[model samples]
Every structure is written in C-alpha cells, then in structure tokens.
Target: MINFESQNLICRFRGIVLQSILWNNDVKSTKYTIKEMIAHHSCLELPEGKSITKADTLEDLAQLYELDDYYWAVKNIHPLTHDLNYVL
Candidate 1:
C-alpha cells in the first residue's frame, strides 16, 4: 500500500478501469468483463487523515452510498444498479 504524508491534502477519482482478472471463479476461470456506467449513487471515502489513527468512527460511511447498490460488493455485483441497471 502507498502512504502519503501531506497536510495540504488533495484527492480525486482517477477513475476506474477493469485492471486485470486472472482468476475469478474458484476453479480459476477467465471471463470477459462488461462494465457500463449505470446511473446511481457511488460513495467514495474522501482521503482520510495522513495517519490511520486520525480516521473517522464509522467505516461504514465510506462504502455506503445514498442509493447505489455498490456493485463492488459480492451480493450486489450482478445487479450493478438498483432501479436503473440498463446501459445508457
């Protein structure tokens, strides 16, 4: 993990890309990933304090969105978005 030490903090979404998926299934299966931006809320943790000790009390807030299904989660993976799951 990379560590940063700066009082003047700045963070931005570098955006997400399908990095690499060598092995997905338990038997190590390769599958073509289809990613489309479905309209929904996506919560991201604004960069935390320089050290872990200065973090907030609720870690849940970081992953919790206002409404999005949070596609990253296992249960929510297939149904990427809740109401609006279709590709635009």
Candidate 2:
C-alpha cells in the first residue's frame, strides 16, 4: 500500500517532471517498463491526458500506468490488436 506522504510526493514530482524525465532518459527501456507495468496490472483503467498529476492515490497510479502502456502499445501495435483488457 502507498502511504499518503509518498503518494503526495509522487503526485508532486510527476506533476513537475515525470514525463520529461521518462521520455528524455532512454526511451526504449522506459517504454518497456511502462508496457510491463500495465501488463502486470491488466485490470486498471487508463485515463486520458498527458498530465501525471492525475494520479492522486495508488488506484490512480494504476490507471496512469495503464494509460502509459496504452500510449506505447498504440504506437507499436494496431489499435485493433491492442487489448482492451483494462478499459472501464
């Protein structure tokens, strides 16, 4: 379980530089990590938008993870081929 303080810190950090840092540092490995994270949490929802500040809790983080996976999956696979396993 994520503690409240840790969650807040995550939200703040992501809101500031999560995307920039992730995409800027080693795109291939970052994408792989995102894909794996989403695959591991196959039941999570993927919310729209580019802001990582959207995650307010562990549940929200799951959704954000899914969104990142979906974003990369769409780029790498046919839309029809991409599994909708996590869609709400």
Query: What tens digits encode model 2's per-residue C-alpha lDDT throughout 1-88?
Result: 9678646644643433345232333334443444344445432254322222344332243345444553455435543333333342
* Candidate 2 weakest lDDT stretch, 10 residues: 43-52
TM-score of 1: 0.14
Q: Model 2, which residues run further than 4 Å from truth? A: 1-23, 43-88
Clashing pairs for model 1 are: none
- The residue-level lDDT of candidate 2 at 7 comes to 68
lDDT, each prediction:
0.21, 0.41
Per-residue lDDT of model 1, residues 1-88, tens digit only: 4335221111221011111111112111111111111111121222221212232211222232111233244333443343232353
What TM-score does prediction 2 earn? 0.27
